[model samples]
Target: MSILLVEDEAPKRKNIRSLLEQMDLLGLVSEACSVGSAIRSLRSSSFDLILLDMSLPTFDIVAGESGGRAQGFGGVEVLRYMDRFKLPTAVIVVTAYPAFSQGDKEIDLTELGKNLEAQHPKIFRGIVFYNSMFSTWRDELKTKIEEVIIR
Candidate 1:
């Protein structure tokens, strides 16, 4: 199966790739370091799964842009694009912040998840935190990926 990995930080991406390799789920992996590149990758190829980082740089290096500021909702933009196009690829959202931890009442992940699901059901396979104080994220990620494979 094909997988698209979208992450901005080099070290984090490397770590995730290592984890996937350990899980024996690292097949045909492709990387996108920014929102623009992720979207372009989506347009160019079909993937069975996408490991998406919520925060990413604004510009796409593959498109000749060197660097750009981080876009806070870069992953959301990619999701919206997939939902708009009705892409069949399953997405697993990875983030450092807790989904409901945002103080903003209207902008928190709870609201975002609800709104997105209302529009495009079954688009998200899971939302996993890369770091958590009370949960084992790595274990959860492995479980979720296994479930995806079964599906």
Candidate 2:
């Protein structure tokens, strides 16, 4: 299966790619460092899965400015675009807000997930947090991927 990985941080993206490779599921994997890049990649090719990050320091190619990180929903816009165009790719949101580093000011993303599902059902397969600082994150991600693949 093909996969599109959307993330901003270089090291994080590298780590995820390594994990995907180790899992033996890295078939035709593509990377996008920003929202604009992700959009461009999607427009050019079709993917079976999209691994997304919520907060991104995206650069808008058209606007020549920042895209969604300030408003704190970069992945939301990408999802909306996919819905608008009826892209038939499955999405899995992986984030690290309010859980690992947010301290006391962490925002609950479940509501956002619910809203997305309400607006566009069946596109989002799962939502997983980036608790990868610890040891179990790899296993969790693997499980989620396996679950999605089976579906």
Please list the C-alpha lDDT of all candidates, in the order they appear.
0.79, 0.77
* Superposed model 2: Cα runs more than 4 Å off: 60-71, 99-106
lDDT of 2 by residue, 1-151 (tens): 8999998876777777878999887766888867778888889999988998877666632356555454257787789889888998999887767432244555566766676678768698767767657756577778888887898
Please report the candidate that would top lDDT against the real structure. Answer: 1
Q: Which stretches of candidate 1 lie above 4 Å from their native place? A: 61-66, 99-112, 132-135
- Displacement of residue 73 (Cα, Å) in model 2 is 0.3
Inter-residue clash pairs, candidate 1 = none
**Cα misplacement distance, residue 44 of candidate 1 (Å):** 1.0
Query: What lDDT does model 1 reach?
Result: 0.79
TM-score of 1: 0.82
